[model samples]
Target chain A: MNRCAVIGIGQTRHAAKRDDVSLAGLVREAALRALADAGLGFSDIDAVVIGKAPDTFEGVMMPELYLADALGAVGKPMMRVHTAGSVGGSTAIVAAHLVQAGVHKRVLTVAFEKQSESEAMWALSPKFPFQPPLLAGAGGYFAPLVRSYIRRSGAPPEVGIKVSVKDRKNALKNPYAHLLLPDISDEVVEKSPMLWDPIRYLETCPSSDGAAAMVLAAEDSLGGVTNPAWVLASEVRSEPTMFAGRDQVNPRAGRDCAKALYAGAGITEPRRQIDVAEVYVPFSWFEPMWMENLGFAPENEGWRLTLDGATSMTGDLPINPSGGVLSTNPIGASGMIRFAEAAMQVRGTAGAHQVDGAKIAMGHAYGGASQFFAMWLVGRDKP
Target chain B: MGEREIAIVSFAEVIVERSDRDDCELLLPVLKRALGDVGLTQQDIGFTVSGSSDFLGGRPFAFVMATDVLGAWPPIRESHVEMDGAFALYEAWVRLQHGDLDTALVFAFGRPSQGPLHDVMSLQLDPYYMAPLRPDALSLGALAARAALDAGLTSEDELARIAGERRGVPTSTSEPYLREPLRAHATPTLRDGAAAIVLAAGDGARALSKRPAWIRGLDHRIEPHSLGARSLTRSVSTEQAARGAGALGFGADVAELHARFAHEEPLLSRALELPASTRVNPSGGALAQDPVMVTGLCRLGHAARAVHEGAARAIAHATSGPCLQQNLVCTLEAR
Candidate 1:
């Protein structure tokens, strides 16, 4: 297989409403920026791969057809991936595979969610025939999982608040981040209204309109890029949404995916070998939950890493230095942002949020009741 | 492009006018049959990918529930596409090229009967310009048929004959038109259906079937979305994909095309440039049983089946979008 590298990355400035641009304009902004970053044009791309959470979110079925012209995909192979919230990460992996499989030299992958176009909460909580109504939305569905994690790990209520504040503070450094909470503090998060039991309003991700894009190319296709983030390993694993012995708090798919990724990348200890990580933490508590799931910490002790400040920007292994989903969540693009931010970190182009001397990084995303998981390891050196 | 030699080992499908079963229920039997045909189980498969759309059921994340059919206890390497199953097969083929995996499972399901499929398909158009007009799929097809007639690419009588031949009915052009140039017989018979295919690579493919449909070349391409921007009388994407898939002069014994509208048959045939000896749609084609998402996959399955059954070579075509805006062409040979 040919080695694939991230040559360029771009993202939109996330906001509650980007009504100034149409859907085509929203995606073109990121695609153009990514092309500019690569110092190439639409004619250079061999294919286009796009992903989104669901068509219901945008009320457009298979929007890639309409978006072909906007993305300069005319006369090129264009694919649409939908794996729920992890779609963005999966989409990138698909694009990388195109290059790795030697089918295409350079592939453009984009993921976006114009949540301002429609109510995602309503789209997510649909009541099918003979099924009970889902009246509580995503936060409500996940609040119980957070409650279960707290019970199983014995984590204090303050851990979630700390993570919320930490990520928001990191967001202040990211110009494209949606929520720039300059005065984010534990007291403020604690005083916020409780949307769900054991889940505060400040602990959840906000609905933002944004798009993320990346240009992945084979080793030979890196024209003028000097700091391309070489893709070390990429993996996606999924399990049944519900089963008799499923572990919702720590899904087996996530564990298996991480195991495969580390093995492929030849990493024995993720916490030590990996310099930084950008994980999908839509809720603040997910940081700790996923840390354990990803084997960064021992079972039932992930919260200790949070309290010890090991995951902060200046800590030993900074997580989500680009603020993460908690600070800017465009459901479809959140995962790609995580992947793109990790690439930025390894390329040393993260500007203020750059982790010093970062050589290797990991990007993680999960969706569909945590049943689906996509992860990849990238490094400054070629694998 | 000598990547990896992949072939279709087995295929299974179910078609119904309207099924009360949910997506999982509709796919469980087909998945089981596809696995059983190759003497393998879900665990033995290296990767799994599916293509489906959420708009069909008016629900979000509808494909997640379909995973139950696999009994994925240890979890599996899986992915999905909001497209026809033929594209999902394309993804699986790419995954197998990594050399770590030997086999992959691809499937697709759709229940267009639950709602108005034509109206639902209109939403796939440009949201700002086309969707507001609510031009149903049939009307768009009519526009293409009119363009084809005006360009002298095909005649209304020829479309009627093609529709009659595909539907196994007698040709009668005197019938009243459904949309001027297009008659009721010129359209596909919509249905709810599901399809699954098992693919194996190299020696693995040889061990599974007596004769594997080795995929020599596979390619898909897209064209502009605006109807006015493209030549409706011809499918430029189809012609490009055919060239990329190396099917231009590679004469095949059979060709299976996912031509939902009867008028698309000649258009695709012209794009593919098939020899007069090549038999097209021996399995009745989409005009017989058109299952929104599964139709394209079924064409591939039928083409592969011809190779498995003794044909020397075959080519399969799958199309998407209005006026065949996107097309996938796969050339399979029995070697």
Candidate 2:
């Protein structure tokens, strides 16, 4: 297999509504940035791989077909990936695999969600036959999982509050973050209205319109990129949505995905060996939940790490230095955003949110009742 | 660069006008047959991927429920594409090149009979431009047919003959026009179906099938989304993809094409530059039963089976989007 590296990264300035640009325009904004970052043009790309949460989110089925021209995919192989929320990460992995497989030299992968185009609340919870109406939206569905994690972990109620505050503070440093909470604090998060039991509105992610893109190249095709983030490993795993004894909070798929990723990257100790991470934490409590699932901490012990500031920028294994999904959740793009930020950290271009001297980082994304998971490990040095 | 050899060891599909069975039910038997044909089970597959669209099911994460067919209890390294099954096979092909996994199972399902397929398909058009117009599939197909006719590429009688040949009928059988130039017979029947294909690489493929369909070249290309921006008389994407897949090098004995509309047959034939002796739509093609997502891969399956059945070389084409906006060509041979 050929070595692959991330030579370019781009993201839109996430907002509640990007009315100025159409869906195609929204994607082009990120794709153009990525091409510019790589110092290449539309003609340089060999293929295009795109992903999004659902066609319902934009009321357009297989939007990539329509976006062929906008993304300069004419006369080029273009693929559309959809594995629920992990689609962004899954899409990136597909692009990298093309390069790794030596099928293409330079592949452009893009993921986006124009949530403003439709009501995701309705789209996500549409009534189906023989299925009970569990129309609580994303927050309601995850709130109980958060409640279960809290009860099982026995972490103080303040843990979720601290995560909300810290990520929001980190968002202030990210110019492209959707929710720039300059005045964010734990007290403010605690005082916020409880949307779900023990899950405050502030603890949940906001619906935003944005896109994320990256240019993945075979090792030899790094035209002018001096510090490419080498793709050390990537993995995707999935299980049925419901089965006997299935743990939703800490899914087996998530664990297996992380295990494969770590093993592939030759890192047995993720907490000590990894320098930074950008994990999909749509809900603030997912920080600890996923930390445990990813083996960054032991079961029920993940909260302790968060409580001890072990996931903070100045602490060990800083997580979500780009403020994560909670700060800018563009559903489809959320996963790719995590992957891109991880690549940025290793490239030493994360700006204010950069983890100083970060050499190795991990990006993760999960979707659909947490049954699907995708993760990748990137390092500054060749793996 | 020469790619690692991959072959289709087994293929199975079921096409019906409409089925009481759900997507999972439609897929289970097909998958079982495909796996059994190769003397393997779900566990034997190293990677799994599927292609499907949720909009057809009128719900999100519809493909999630289809996983029940895979018996994903212990979990599996799987992924999905919101496309036709042929594209999923393309992904599996790419995955096999990693050299870690030797076998992969690919499947796709769609039920066009359950929804307003024409309107639903319009949703695939440019949301800001074409979708707002709500142009139905037949009218769009008619527009392309008219373009070809006006460009002197084909005649009305040729389309009728193409449609007749696919239906095993004669053009003398008069059919009413659904759209100005497009007769009812020219349009494909809406079908509900699923298809499964097992792909194995190198020695594993040889071990699986005595007559494996060796994929020599596989490539897909897309065109601009706007119908007005393109010349409907020609399939540039098909030409590009056929060239990429090396289909233009000479000709194959048969070419199973995913031409949902009659006019597309000639367009693709010209694009791929198939010889006159090349048999087109031997299994009646998509016109016999166009099950949306499944039809494309079914074309591929049929073409692979032709090679497995003694044909020296064959070509399979799968198309997505309106007016052949995107096309994938795969050339297979028995060696």
Candidate 3:
């Protein structure tokens, strides 16, 4: 297979509502930025791959069809990927495969969500026959999982609070982050109302409108590009939503996905080799929960890594230096944002959040009640 | 990278005017038949992918629930596309090109019976410009049909004959128009359906079928969303995709065109440059039963079936968006 590399990355300034631009405008902004970053234009793209959570999120079914002209995909191969929350990452992986498979020399991949267009809660909680309503929204669905984690781990209550404080503070350094809370602190987090049991409002991600795009090229096509982030490996794994003995907290799909990813990249020790990480932490507790699931930390001990400041910007491995999904929760774009930020770190263009001398990084995303996983590893050097 | 040979080994679909069965229920039997056709079980598949729209189900993450049909117990390397099943098959074909994977299971399901399909499909238009105008899908088809009629590319009589022949019914030119130029016969028969196609690479493909429908070329393209911005009479995207997929030079023995509207058959036949001798829509095509998301994939399956069933070569065409704004073309040949 031909090697693939991330030649450019672009993202919108996440916000509660980007009323200034329509859905097409929002995506075009990111696509234009990505094309410019690659020192290319729309005409340079061989194909386009787009992903978003649900069409209901923006009241548009098959948005990519309408978005064809805006993305400059007219008369070119274009595809739409939808794997729920993991869609962004999955979209990127599919784009990379197109390059790796040598089908396309350059590919543009995009993911976005215009949450302001409709109530995602209403869309997600639609009542179906013989199926009970999910009135609690995403938080309600995950709070029980958090409670189970806490009960099993015996971790202190402050772990989630610490993660919330750290990530929001990190958001201050990211100009495009939606929530740059300068006043975020332990006191403020504690005062925040609890939306779900043991899950404070401050610990959850806010609904935001944004889009992220990446320009990926085959190794041979990276002639004019400098400092491209080589994609070492990409993997996606899925499991049935409900089955016997399925572990939601540390899902087998996640563990198997990580194992497959590392094995593909020939990385025996992820914690030591991976210089930085960008993981989907929609909820604060998901940081530690995903850490264990991704094999970054042992089961029940993931919180200790957070408490020890090991995941901080100045610590051993900075997680979500761009503040992650918690700070900018455009459901569809969240996963691609993680993947793009990881690439930026390796490209040494992450600006204030850049991990110093970072050569290798990991990006992870999960969706569908933690039953789906998409992960990729990028390095400064070609694999 | 070296190009790898991939072929469609098996195909199955369930089409109905309206399905009382749920998405999973509709998909289970199709999946079983698709797997059984290749003499392989779900466990034997290397990857699983699906294409569908959550909007059709009036819920979010609808495809996740549909995974129940795959019996995804041990977890699988899978992905999904919020598109026609042909796109999912494209993704699977791309995955198999990586050399590590062999067989892939692809399926698409939709039940348009839950809501007004015209209004539902209108949601696929541009929200800022087109959707607010609420131009229903049939109206768009009418507009295209009118454009083609005015351009002298086709006529009302030709459309009537195409519809009648495909539907195996008598066409009435005197019937009242459903949407100006488009009569009821010209519009698609919105239905509920599910389709599954199993793909295998190289040795696996040859092992699965006595005459595998080897995918010689597969490509898809999209056009501008605005109907006024481009010529509605011709499908530029389909022609481009046909050229890219190498379906232009070869003459197909049979063609399964996803002509959701009667007027689309002539547009696609022209775009694909199909031979006059080609037999189009032998299985009646989309006019017989248009199952939204599954209709496009069913075109591919039907075309593959021809090659698998001893035809020398065939062309499968799938379309998306309003007025044929997007198109996918695949060239299949027996090997």
In model 2, the clashing pairs are: none
Model 3: docking quality category: medium
Cα lDDT tens digits for candidate 3, A1-383: 88999998999988999999988899999999998899999988999999999888888889998899999998898999999899899999999999999899999999999999998876777667755356678887888999999999988999999999989988899989999889899999989999988889899999999999999999888758889999999999998877667789889999999999999999999889999999999889999998899888999999998999999999898999999888998899999999999999999999988889999999989998888899999999978
Q: Can you write out model 3's per-residue Cα lDDT over B64-91, one digit (the tens) per residue?
A: 8876679886889999999899989999
DockQ of each: 0.88, 0.79, 0.78
Docking quality band of candidate 1, CAPRI definitions: high
User: Model 2 residue B194 lDDT?
Assistant: 94
**Which residue segments of model 2 deviate by more than 4 Å?**
A130-133, B170-173
- Of 1 and 2, the candidate ahead on TM-score is 1
Each model's fraction of native contacts: 0.89, 0.81, 0.89
Best by DockQ: 1
Can you tell me which runs of candidate 3 are displaced by over 4 Å? Answer: A130-133
Listed in order, each prediction's TM-score against the native is 0.99, 0.98, 0.99
